[model samples]
Target: MTNKIDLDFLRVTHLRGPNIWTYRPVIEVVIDLGTLEEAPSDKIPGLYERLVAWLPGLVVHRCGVGEHGGFLERLREGTWAGHILEHVVLELQNLAGMKTGFGKTRGVGQHGIYKMAFRTRDEHVGRAALAAGRELLRAAIADLPFDLATHVEALRELVDEHCLGPSTAHIVEAATERRIPALRLTDGNLVQLGHGAAQRRIWTAETDRTSAIAESIASDKDLTKSMLAACGIPVPEGALVRSADEAWDEAQDIGLPVVLKPYDGNHGRGVSLNLVTEEDVRAAYELASRKGDSSSVIVERFITGDEHRILVVGKHVVAVARGESLWVVGDGVSDIIALVDSQINTDPRRGSGEDAPLNALAPQHGAEIILELQRQGLTAYSVPLAGQKVLIQPNGNVAHDVTDRIHPSVAHAAALAARVVGLDIAGVDLVCEDISRPLDEQRGAVIEVNASPGLLAHLKPAEGPPRPVGKAIIAHLFEDGEHGRIPLVGITGTLGTSLIARLVGCLVSLTGAQVGVASGQGLYLNQRQVAAGDCTGWDAGQRLLINRTLTTAVFESNARRILAEGLAYDKCQVGIVTDVEGAAGLAEFYIHDADGVASVVRTQVDVILPHGTAVLNAEIDAVAEMAALCDGQVIFYAADADHPRLLAQRAAGQRSVFVRDGAIVLGDGAHEQVLLALAALKPTTASWPTSVLAAVAAAWALDVEPTILAAGLRTFDAAATASKRA
Candidate 1:
């Protein structure tokens, strides 16, 4: 019997934000390769070849060698199981269509134990991938039969079920490219795109500005057509009908070859096109009624042209996708189902998931396909003669890009249709013989105006180039030179950081802005203590960020929270570090010395925006040294006016906060302003001068007026603040 190597998973942690690893979410797994510790990949017989056979995509991983096939080179030259596991998990996720590459493996100073981390878009999918990767690797090492295809399929299903759909991710990625921060608000596509009061919300293609009334009008097809026709935009004549008799009557009145569809249907569901017979019309009416929210159906004059979906954002049309009929040629050996599977579904663009540009047609499941086959006296099980072309679907395959070919008048008509329906973002379905010609010239007509339309067709069209629909949507939500960020301050240190956060929040609130403070004292919205406990962690900080009413936010963090969970916010307008102090209880995190503590705390400085400022205590050399690491300007604060770092910074025309002649002073090299007399604030701030100075410097960086700062300082109740912390 072969002795199987034992690889045990010690722990798996999902860091949901920027952490010590990188500036994105990653899954950290601690693995103990007990007996296999002595057996590297080269030592394990047949392991390297088996892994390569299973996951050939691992060749792209650069690993430590930093080039293509570097991981394979490592496998040949000998490497640890943990390192192999990292590459395997990443490859599995890539094959499952998530496309993540960042990963690392580090030793924890223990024999046979290592921590491996890899980037993942969703935590649930990451955990599942890790488990599958572990099992696959173990099977390969043991020379056990493992079905790689089954595992990959399972991972793909998990990804489809949990991760953000492709359309939502595209929009979020575009927002990130614009330096706008995004927070997923649900397991679904709902996302918030900025911080606090400056934020905007989006759910797939729809934005917060998408009016409820507009969406209602867009859903009702008859109403939408009426509104468009009234606005002088060309629309197909349509009338709502209640039953099969009424549907046929309306179709006859509109003339033969009319289209029958649900009155409030979406995604082409329950829609049958170009029916010239009474039997086909009645059957389509039944199908439409079953698919719609109500029993109502619409019969419209079938416009003689290929179907097109025009995407409109704000005041302009951004993208256009033209549809084509789907057909399959039989070889005389297979039925319609087999032909579709072999010919059409075999296209790489077709899939059952949202990632696919076009949806795979399942004859057994699709009612429309069944009905279409019945129209041609063909069933899914019927076999056609050799060289016979059978129509599987007419229209609804709107994945071919025609944006550049669209005439300006047609674009304007689509945009006007969206405006008539009151949609900020709309998908206008128009049928025209040629997109390059004007709609009036070709007798093209707008058939439907849709809200929250699927964007994947434009993002990854089967033909032509993919459009920047996601960028267009984001641009529509946020104006030029706006990233949707509110004024934010983050404070990190051991010495009275909570007091510093509270003071900053109070001073900012005096500027007539609603403030949210997350600190050790508790979670505060303005002056109200909503939750009383240790609120200095990532969860606490997120509460402040997601609050729509909050105009300004202050967060208090420490070395332990920074090491365990990342800072709550992505970037701050002002970052304050009062002191590095020490890593007393952080031995568990492997942070032993002051240097380790300094590295952890400096994360606060690392996240300052380019136009922001960092407030550092000049007394602590470790804290003051972090000034150079900031992307923005730095403000030094100390009780002593003669502090060298403060003095040098002031000399260079930079800002500094210090005490002079019994008063707190805000100074540049060329000018100085006395903020307040220390005697007036002695009752509240004298006990913790360092914290007070840090807060004042942070407020100054936030552009708070000196008089309001003094008022906030004098009115602060040190006793009440201390009690809250307790």
Candidate 2:
């Protein structure tokens, strides 16, 4: 939580073996907190840790850049070094501050980001830091000393005076100036400002194509009824009853066995079922009437039949589950005390953190049980007869409590319900005895839907066995097209909105693949339309799209479009959306409705972006992280001299090429060179452009054979030209 930033977080050493280390020039960082000065050789705390862990096989600087007298000094000499330094600086800026949410937010800062990173640097790091950082930033926003407008002015002043570094301070200035709220990340990746941050929660191939999941559509039971009606889902005739009397009135018309529950509640809360009489109806209605402030209550006919939760995220159906009728097994030998204790410990209430097993439906008690036991010729203290199964009616105080042993059909229903709710990740609740039966059975009903489903109950397993529901959630939400088969060569850009259609076309032509241009327009294009387009919109218009997708040369237009989608979906797999991060007059449409509904919406037109000036004010490292999102082998082309920074960062990860001539040449040296290689692509394998000569020379020193290197240089001349012609 400290405001002062650490500067010596540098000194990356490339690791090749157990003990061997090699040095690549690295850009170092030194925060000169003049007042909090340190001795000349003060070893930074987390700096050495990063070097030891993250740079295991990659090249790193021997002498870290240091801080002197309140300023980071001694910028590195090589293009690679400067690029790496800039990356660290931008991270520090996020550490120092950057607005949370999508890139469109106003400020830079997140909460408690540093704490988790300090805890783990490996797999647990990114998601942990992102979760905490955003939370911290979301909270800090309301308590800012001055307005966002005022903060921006101050940040600008700080940058103009060089008080803050160019890449990081500029972020503070940008976020503040824009009024989107910002936070500078500190150690552990803490969001230094704001609260309730919502960013980086999505990064996947399935769903989330347009960022539509984050936005919530609001409505009451009436809205639910309407949506169901439109989707043509079978629904029992019902009305929104605001009061117990109205509920009873509505229930009367619908006959016996009614159900009452909240209109906007998630999970299985505030609901009552199997009420057959006027008295039963009154109790259920009263309970539902005490709804949460953010929700509403509804009374309706409780259909007698089997139910299923069908979940569809984007385009894929994730899971389905059948609700089981609630029942408690009797050990016959154990006292009620042991039974209740054992059950409550199963799948406990929400946020209670304590596992509540028997407590799920309704915790058993001595008082209520005495009556039932007496009827069975036994008292609470008396041992139950062997092999006896007790069915307890949920009087106002109790309801179906156990969902841990649900039927497979119920699981299927849960997935279906998630799909029905239009969320990539969701949980559905069904109340039924025989899950495998058809949904029209007279003993089951679908209760509610949850957008973010938790499977702790299924995980710990209250009863028979444990299910990997959590893993299923991960798969449903994260898994993309079959990884090994897709062969997606991701292309990125800083100004991709300006070149999306062309980029796709270029890729298709180069790979001898096919395009899905019409898919973005809502058309389920066959192989026919993909080959028919002129490749116009796919060319320059997606500058905004590719950048946000991976930011090789992204533009603002693409950033805005993705942000506007709110969340991604699985359906985008075959869709060809473009110009994200850009604003169109209307919102970019996503496949949210069912297949029947979606078919009517898609027409496959080229995406258009709002025009704007290009902005390239981000730190190199930030851009590199964006590039890594491509998640595929990609070829980066750049003439602008700034794109190669992506290559340097990407080098640690995938098979990304620094394209110049027809043949690929490994790029080394400075950030500037990396940028140049990524940006320029007239697609000509021209006269041995010495532009890559310096990098080639560095490779020669690294022991690459001179003859092979020379041949590489020669190959680009003809290959690049041939690529251009193609």
Candidate 3:
């Protein structure tokens, strides 16, 4: 009809876990690039220049050539629209503040049909980026104007809405660095780290170990102060007052300069500092009382010094941030509000977003700022003379890192304050003349003990280097040498994988651990079927790993599942491959032979933990070839004890499981042990010698005792398991 190019999305799938593409969550979109399939970038006038001009970050995308400016090289040489779309989507996401680098595009055997995938932290954001990328690419191809800023802003809104907050993400990143798997428990910040019984849950800065009573005590400022005072930790003298009159009376009783705030408040909201007059104190009381559900306000002596926040994790002070009073130097033309906008809010670190280290200041919008202005005999509209200084905020922007300058005694007081309040992780707010000097020497005091404190200030400090507060919190949750992982086994193959998984599950359960099995037969938790009918995919595996009562887990996957959904867990203690035999239902995925199946099946071995083991069937040449792909130890299994691969594995000082006469044998190079007789196994396993050998190898890798392995095999009932699922 015309020379116009067009693209139609055929399908979009969110691969939530590892897949054939990679070991991360990716959004895969199948597109039909109608006429654009023939229109390579080099053939399209101004297309390459337009794209590079809009997304200059695309030059860093190594793409297929695997070097800087590789994507640009491909575009200049000649490339299809689908490949260009992949890079565009990734660049869009990067500009939207979610940095991800992995992407791929390939033809689907059809003339114009192609599949494109890119890594994303959130699926919703990924889909939004895809839609925007498609529109932008089409507009560029048609030589039409596209508003890149509007699209980037929309994608950024989606990122803020769907992605984890910076604090939670920092903690999750730390956990990932330690090889601890994390699962988001909610759409919000609630997340679970580790697997099954070893897992710990965190919501932002708070963890499962944070006590309800401790949080309650921290919320009540008066009680927290009293407790700190009693524990010999210096605390501000404060009293709760009910009415505005009572607030002034308490302030007078305390002294001329006083601090008034809500009895239970956070984030410095509804707080007035350094009040010397009854008018200011009474007005501050009304502002403070309106903040929280409480009507009472606290009147305390104003400790004259810079405000400081010390982060305490366990018994150690991990990070410290100092707050400086905000001031504006008048240029003689701008009012207070205009000055705040031009001087304070204009700082790149200040914004309304969670990623911003400091919040933008607006005197007109904040009650505390308005009250502070009133005390200074000024309002938001007041303009000072040139070079004259006006204090806009007296306190409460604790974002300059002072951790290295904090005195040891001050650090101890903060840690002790947190301990006194009974919080495993806390932010202790204090005021002192100098952080390098002790608090007692400067008449400084612990003003508040805050539970679930904000971590942004320490993580992205305005002045000093960012602190590892997230790592400190993670370390408090998990000790050294503990990754918060339980023993896990993953089985993948085309034959007898379900049975092997179930057998291994049963064997591990004999050690008094509650084992969960997700296999083709069904999903079993401690031998009880929780779900039935082919539970050998990512979702079922996730259920097992997330179950709080599960002490150990076994998962079964086939070549098809590996190609389609990826393994559920990140790594496993034992990965078993029975035989890479079948390619029957994989034609849809373009996998038509055992070699293709072998490549898919090797994903199981590829994910084995370095300290873990891979149990391979030495009988199958394809499966035996994957032993070298394992990052961990290998245990070859076969029906014949003298199988050459098994003998070689044994000679290499590795483990092997095989059948010798009528007995199952376990050998480690020079030593051999008869674990049990084949006659001792249940009748159901009599014709499943290979499956039995695979199961025995996996169980041995998991450190199941020889005696327990024998007993579990003798008692395992396939009929009962199937009936239970039924």
Candidate 4:
């Protein structure tokens, strides 16, 4: 009992996309529980109590029992360390602000060793959380002290650095909901949705359709204002100024209570609002100059009202968020900094990171705040009299959702302003006394048009319901009937999978589409080899997916690849299983028996798109069994038309491909058409029944004409023979 419990990770693999476990990225860890395997939660005195005390959020995990407090019940009833670790790891990630719930634990046949997988948004954060969870769990088990808050804070910082920012993640999540696959192009916000030539990239709210010219236009405030005014859209009068003297002159010309800010600056940086004094305008000009690379600053008439941000996507206003000024009441006992902290930062929605809707108020972060305080004759150390209200920020905290209350005319004007600025997606900042009233009636005017606008306000608003701005942006990027996918084919089995994959690629290429293939021979682009030596892996498949010139892709999957790394692609339009020739040479992955081999091979069928088809070899009983697992249509293929599964498929008015009278016959129930004579096919392909039949079935599923498929088969046979001879 005095011995310290230890956990060791034997292996760690990051499944980048959909895998056998689930349809998302996951960190699969194989861990050696060592002596801890003998000890369950209930056996370790006070372990359950300690875990519940540390992570009370475990109550919401509707575990196997499927209700509130189900996991806690399991903890009390005695669960193994592997199961406990799964829940603990997930809970740690949740506490760290990267919420996730999917996890699984399975025994690896080796004594005291197990495999655990958990959903993860970022690989770095997931690994860090796993290490932290192991240490925290050990401490909890041994009744040792653990700094939970410090660990959680570090994890949150990691999330901020490694994971996608809120706006980009929101859009990615929306794309996922629409069943569009996505790949993070970099560690930052650059993300690709869909695959190959059909993919669209986005960095936050700016999509592939977002114009660089529009971004430049939005950056120039004076030009943007003029464009809106010229297009009959309400826009505030503004003038660019060079020096403090000119800023004061512009303020006077526009009348008192003018707003001063950098011409190209965004996110309310270096902005001074409702200024009536020359001294304030002069000081603000100095701050504005530092924010912009250019020396120019803009001074405009300050409209009297709450500030609002309207999100426009593809000529439509999708969301509106209103902003309010912040104030702190003097407690008389505390200084300005302490009073601001105790009053304003006390709100849970305010934090130092972008995850929080409202930013924590700190004097050091902004000179504008200090200047505002000085205008009221108070510094960070100054203590105000009791009951005195001091203004902190005059604007820029747009966190109130007002989408439902937006006046039609106001929404129209916002969309028009975005169009005038030439942005496909934009954030329009306008001032209005009442958003429910028309702009002309309320003297409302668009003050700023911003490209790559922050979407946090609408996504996680401080007040009112959250808006579906992510969905709007996704709709704008991909119009109706576009899933952002190119044609993809997958082949799996022990016999002739690589050859079948190449043949399918050849048939797809005959249609004039650029085809990319990854198989045992090599990675090929339209018959040109790009990489050599066993290219049937995740890395080779990823290259094809990311290639912008590839219109079609074919991948070869084997049992070893499935057990070790999972499939390379997310899902496939056509999945072909030539035959289950039996599991051999896979003992290294702990897949020893026939059942295990069948399970591993079924991963291919599991990924078939519902609208697509699965071409199964009816001759192999194990492969024939996979037809039931496909989410889409099934096309049975065998050498004999009398094969039971093939006969059943044809009887059920389904498609089947077989050989009859020395010819390949494609049959749909009562109708049968002879595609090509077996003798006419090249000697190499005709000799392999699994390869030729599977290729023909897959090509038929891809809608390649029979004549073209015949030509592709002949061409592939000649090339494959040449490769072997060479």
Clashing pairs in 3: none
Q: Where does the lowest 10-residue lDDT sum fall in candidate 1?
A: 717-726
| lDDT of every model, 2 decimals | 0.90, 0.34, 0.89, 0.87
The residue-level lDDT of candidate 2 at 597 comes to 20
**Which digits, one per residue and each the tens of the lDDT, describe model 1 over residues 648-669?**
9988999999999988999887
Error of 2 at 685 (Å): 20
The TM-score, computed over Cα atoms with residue i paired to residue i, of candidate 3 is: 0.96
Q: Whole-model lDDT for model 2 versus the true structure?
A: 0.34
Candidate 2 lDDT over 645-671, as tens digits, reads: 435534545222244433434434332
| Candidate 1: pairs in clash | none
* Candidates in order: C-alpha RMSD to true structure: 2.4, 19.6, 2.1, 2.3
Worst ten in a row by lDDT for model 4: 717-726
Tens digit per residue, CA lDDT, model 3, 1-726: 253558899878887766767878898888999988888889888999899889999999998899999999999999999999999999999999998999999886789989898999999899999999999998888888899999999999999999999999999999999988899988999999999999999999999999999999999999999999999998777799999999988888888799988889988889899999989999999999999669989999999899999999999999999999999988888999999999899999999999999999889888998988888888899998899888889876799999999999999999999999999999999999999998778899999999999999999999899999878888999999999899889888767787888888888989998999999989998888888898987888889988999999999888877767778888888999887777878876667888878878888888889999999888889888888888889999999888888878888888999889889999989799998898887788867888988998998998889999999988887666443644
**Can you give the TM-score per candidate against the true fold?**
0.95, 0.37, 0.96, 0.96
lDDT at position 157, candidate 3: 98
Clashing pairs in 4: none
Q: After superposition, how far is residue 96 of candidate 1 from its true place, in Å?
A: 1.5
> What is the Å distance of residue 366 in model 3 from its true position?
0.7
